[model samples]
Target: MFQFLRKVLMIELAGLNRFLLGQDLDLNIINSEVSRCNNNILADLTNDVLSVKSKFADYINIKLGKKKQGEKT
Candidate 1:
């Protein structure tokens, strides 16, 4: 049932994203579930966080090369 719940969460979160940053956060969650994590819950959460980090505000800043991290994209 975890998989079922995860899919629901993903869809709900995706639709609820009013801001694009929130959408990125939702993408990070989906990326987390891409790894099975051996069904370990902690590992799953850790992967979710790691995916957020991998979305690297620094890289995004470099891409725009001017906008700061919290400028509301």
Candidate 2:
């Protein structure tokens, strides 16, 4: 079950990656899957996915020349 869930998350992340590269910024699917993982007691996996998602967001922001509030340049 854990492996299955991990694979599902990986697929979702891949989709997100494609969208991110295309500048789509649609995170609904990944966000829902992460929440589902958390509710299923997969805390570690959830954290890992969240970390990757954060990195994706950061990359998108960098590509768009957007800076986070209070972030030092």
TM-scores of all candidate predictions against the true structure: 0.29, 0.36
Q: Write the per-residue lDDT of candidate 1 for residues 16-62, one digit (tens) a residue.
A: 44344345456766556543332464466558767766778667868
Task: Give the poorly placed runs of model 2, Cα more than 4 Å off.
Answer: 1-41, 66-73
* Candidate 1 Cα misplacement greater than 4 A, ranges: 1-39, 56-73
Per-prediction backbone clash count: 0, 0
lDDT of 2 by residue, 1-73 (tens): 5577778867866665565556544578656654665465556777877887799999998866655544656
Q: Mark the 10 consecutive residues where model 1 has the least summed lDDT.
A: 33-42
**Predictions in order: lDDT:** 0.57, 0.67
By lDDT, who's the top model here?
Answer: 2
- Model 2 residue 56 CA deviation (Å) reads 0.4
CA RMSD of all predictions: 16.5, 16.9
Error (Å) of candidate 1 at residue 19 is: 36
Evaluated at residue 21, the lDDT of candidate 1 is: 38
